[model samples]
Target: MFGIDVRTARVVWTAALVLLGLYCIYTMRTTLLVMLFGVFFSYLVYPLFTLAQRACGLRVPRTLVLLVVFAAVASIIGLVGLLFGNQIVAEATNLGQQLPKLLQPGELERRLPLPAPLEPLRVRLGILLQHLLEGGTAQALPVVRGLGTSLFHAAGNLIYVVVVPIFSFLMILEAPWIESFLASLAQRPDGRLWSNVARGLNDVLSQYVRALALLVLATLVSYSVTLGLLGVPFTLLLAGLAAVLEIIPVFGPLIAALTIIAVAVFSGYGHVWWLVLFFAAYRIFQDYILNPWLMSEGVNVPAILVVFGLLAGDELAGVPGIFLSVPVIAALRMFAVQVRLHRAARLNAGGAAQG
Candidate 1:
């Protein structure tokens, strides 16, 4: 319109549309997150859906199959929560009460006898805690004041939880159509290319999700059992937190270890040293044996790339980014491999044409 040529006008229109789309996405990020989570969950449960469909001789509605799968999952979660909820709440309350005292200026010194050599370090820590206490109190007042607002915000999360399952059910029902629609965006010659990429990405994501789920479940079960046997308070709560954090990689286990040790110290658990030793051994076992065993067949993503992806994802988008980082990295790696293969094939074709 502003004296632009046809090609230039088309380019300007495309750029404007792209920017508008970006703005829309940014505005709807929260809803998008819920939908993305639903999609990922659908990927994880797709195989079960197929099996259920087959069991019904492919006569039952897809929605019914989804409900069965959802019911099964919800029942397991509800049963576990019912079994341990009260104990976890009580232990969590006690832990909350103890944490402030631990962070107090002289609380650590009073609780733990320091050798003469470490006395200076203890003094420094006390001074640091004093400064932190002053700042923390100021920060805590605002949080306390906003507690009611936070409760309302939490209520909104209920909608998100409801929406996720609904989205997942819909996604499962339309999965085949979605695949075809995506593939059709490419021309005939490139449709197969798009389909292959989609298939590869789907396999990688599903395998990673399943492997991660198994690993987390094993960690939860193993830790809960071991800690309970060792007479740890809040074993269920501690183990559940550990399982959830296990998804975060490297620092997750470290934080979980610290939490258990802190609880032991506060609760007068006599086996503090033993608990520490156990966590150390467990970390070694998990990193060396369990994780590789679970992930090796499916993910096989390099350690360095995983760590880097986690850092990058966390930096960019926080927890959701962290959760999706591994899958995204695997998909990117798959795309790179396919691109390289395609490039090689093109070069071979060109050479034959020249011959």
Candidate 2:
């Protein structure tokens, strides 16, 4: 083999195999993403699955229980979408059609007035916003030029929407085997490390799912009820949008608030000040109180670390990176803690042997 010794030949072969594996992984990254999303969804729904099975009692077969629960979930989602999806779509379409006209030069300025002292700032903000929108549309044009132009992306998105849930269901069916497989990969034969890993992951994952559910539910209910009480038009649409957007970190809520206010301004809603006040109060509640309380026992991460993770993730992998950043961080922290514990245990054992 090109004059290489046997050891060198083995090393080269091993390196080649490693590189080939990496290349294969890179090539199948998109499919891997879909599978990963399926797994993620399964994690979110696992607690619910457990609850459903428990409610079914021991007599009911587990697979049957899962099938029934899955059906119920699908039905509920379909019903809700049927009842509200059209209205939401219509509102979105109207907004899309009207926003360009509404954002024309001075239109925004005329709609949103400020005190004389801040009048110059208002004009500047309007100009800046127009420029941003123009730039954004220009950037987005290629991604959304037309159905024909974006067919591949459209198909990929369809795969995400349609296939992901089915894959998640399949993952749910194989959850126990998957967990065992994961545990078997641990270094310790006694399984203590795997136990810690599994328990830590379960805690964080369940808490994440619970926190997300609560945040979305609370946002939708509070926004809809309060806005409806205050006679806000498009209450359902706005509330639903905010609820859905709650899944995305930081920027999502900000965008929701801005959109709500913008819509209020455009629609001549007299309670713009009240809407602003409500959003500010709700934000304070969400940031300083609600989220902290929900996730305190789980990740318990500092806000600064989460911010850094988000920045790095966004830079490295864009939207999916942002979505996975927190989970990865929490998992890493758990792993670090476990490693420390294992090291301390080993040191103690060695010390006792010496004694």
Candidate 3:
């Protein structure tokens, strides 16, 4: 009775520690999320750091490489701001001024031309709009303002903006040490089964992240250049916003499209039809051509699983979680497959021994 089974005790201890750790994580999830974003940002920029390091004959430390990369990115952003910052600020101010008028009960009636046959429908819409403006708008305005404020607040969070970069830098600087430790773990008897699993996860996640970043960057550049050429108001802001939203799954693109179309319509942009056609064509091109070339081959996650994962992630942690969901699901699948293979091998070995 006093003697505990070795395996049972081990399992009990492990389970207790895991549960405790999970509880801690649940409580501190917001902090963990900021760190995770730092990790993601590091992953995206890592290849550039590696390239710069190699170009310096590997004498340049990763820390220096990271700093240089960050500086370069900052310079580019600053230059762009210098070029178009005033335009963006002016457009944003104009939009802000216009929003209240647009939300007025009669504003829609004035802007939108309804057919005589739809007069009743128009009247109903006016009533609905009046309700929204009179009662709901007060509530809605805070929510909208909160949404924007929360986004920038997260970015401006002292811990996020400062500590995250430090964490990212440490992670980058100590990556080799981390890999060595993981490799050492793999040498342990219990870890043999997971050695390949670790390596496979690294490969899969690295490739997926790099590809995804490239896709986002390509989309941003395409949107900015094309929209500018087409004389879209707030080209930089809209394109940048679209690129950020593109990181989210299904609903993101739709929201961006609707927002842009609404602006075009209300602003009396005569090229609204052209804008629609261009967006339609670009959507087709991206879905059929660009996505296949970049992502459709490598990840190969089932459509249903992808949808479910996105929904679950969105439910869990909003947009950032949505961004994390795919690679995480893919990694879990790889682990499951590895475990199944290992279990099969053990069973086969047992059968052979019996024979």
Candidate 4:
């Protein structure tokens, strides 16, 4: 009104809106994370939903199919918990009880005998290890506490657990409606590029999520069997930890190996040397063969790019960022491809018009 140019005002308004939206995101990041995870899990659930519907020849109602699929997944989780949950808990409790004793001064030296050549340095070695462990644990306390708080909050919030599933269920059922809404906003006059991008992202996400689940299961089984056969203490506990951490890619298995070997050495396992060799071999097999085969269809990002993404993601958002970096990079790559296709189509149409 006060001599503002119309175009300038419009630009100002758009910028303001973007800033407001960013503020909202910052304020509600926790809710957004939950929603994001719900969307991720919906991709996981939808394929099973589709598969079950196909198995039933589409005779069953979609809602019924979804319910049965969810029920089966829940039942399998519950059954696994029933089978191994108590022992894992027992092992965790035992670890808590034993950790203080393990940290006692000279305990490392007493428990770990030096080779004859290094026998004189046993006390120094123990002292160095004790100082390092205490220092590291002290430095790590805040992160560990934050993680524990997050887990406790997730477990304690009944609504969150229910809400996440409800989101997945609604997403599956109302997918068409959601698509239409997004289309209304996203579709452009000159091209259907947005739709194509969405589809590519969907395919990448679905395949990545399913493949990741399979990888985790394989790690759990392989580690459990190998550790149990090797008579390693806390086989189930360590295996479960490895499986959970396996989602983080490159650093996950390394941490698991170091932790497992440290536990073996501290617990006086005789075959610690054998465990080291086995882990080294297994890491090679998993990284070079198993990971590539599983992720080939979905994510084609190079190993160097993946490592860089992990570092960038870790800097930006810590562990969750590291876990999501590959998929995010894949989606971005897909977006770039769609843009190139759109540009080429425009060029071809322009040439045709000139002809």
Report, for every candidate in turn, its global Cα lDDT versus the true structure.
0.80, 0.81, 0.77, 0.85
Clash number by candidate, in order:
0, 0, 0, 0
Q: Worst 10-residue stretch by lDDT in candidate 2? A: 142-151
List the candidate 3 regions with Cα displacement exceeding 4 Å. Answer: 2-15, 59-63, 103-107, 113-139, 148-156, 296-300, 345-355
Local error of candidate 2 at 92, Å?
1.1
Task: Give the distance in Å from residue 16's predicted Cα in candidate 2 to where it truly belongs.
Answer: 6.8
Candidate 1: tens digits of C-alpha lDDT, residues 226-344: 89999987788899899998887777888888878866755657677778788888888888887787664446777798899999998878677888888888888888877787678
Model 1, runs deviating above 4 Å: 1-17, 59-61, 100-107, 113-152, 178-187, 296-304, 353-355
lDDT of 2 by residue, 280-327 (tens): 999999988998988855576667877888899878776777877787
Better of 3 and 4 by lDDT: 4
| Per-prediction TM-score to the true structure, in the order listed | 0.81, 0.82, 0.82, 0.89
lDDT of 3 by residue, 1-355 (tens): 7888999999999999999999999899988887877777677768877888889876776677889987786688689889878877887889878877776657676655456888768767777766865786678788888789988887676666777767777788888997887899778867867787887787767777776787678778988998888887778778877777776656677778878877765565557777788779878987778777776443657778888999999788766678888888888888887788879988998899999
Q: Supply candidate 4's per-residue lDDT for 85.
A: 100
Question: Which ranges in model 2 have alpha carbons more than 4 Å from their true place?
Answer: 1-22, 116-152, 156-162, 178-191
- Write down the worst ten-residue block by lDDT for model 3: 291-300
Q: Is candidate 1 or candidate 2 better by TM-score?
A: 2
- Model 1 vs. true fold: TM: 0.81
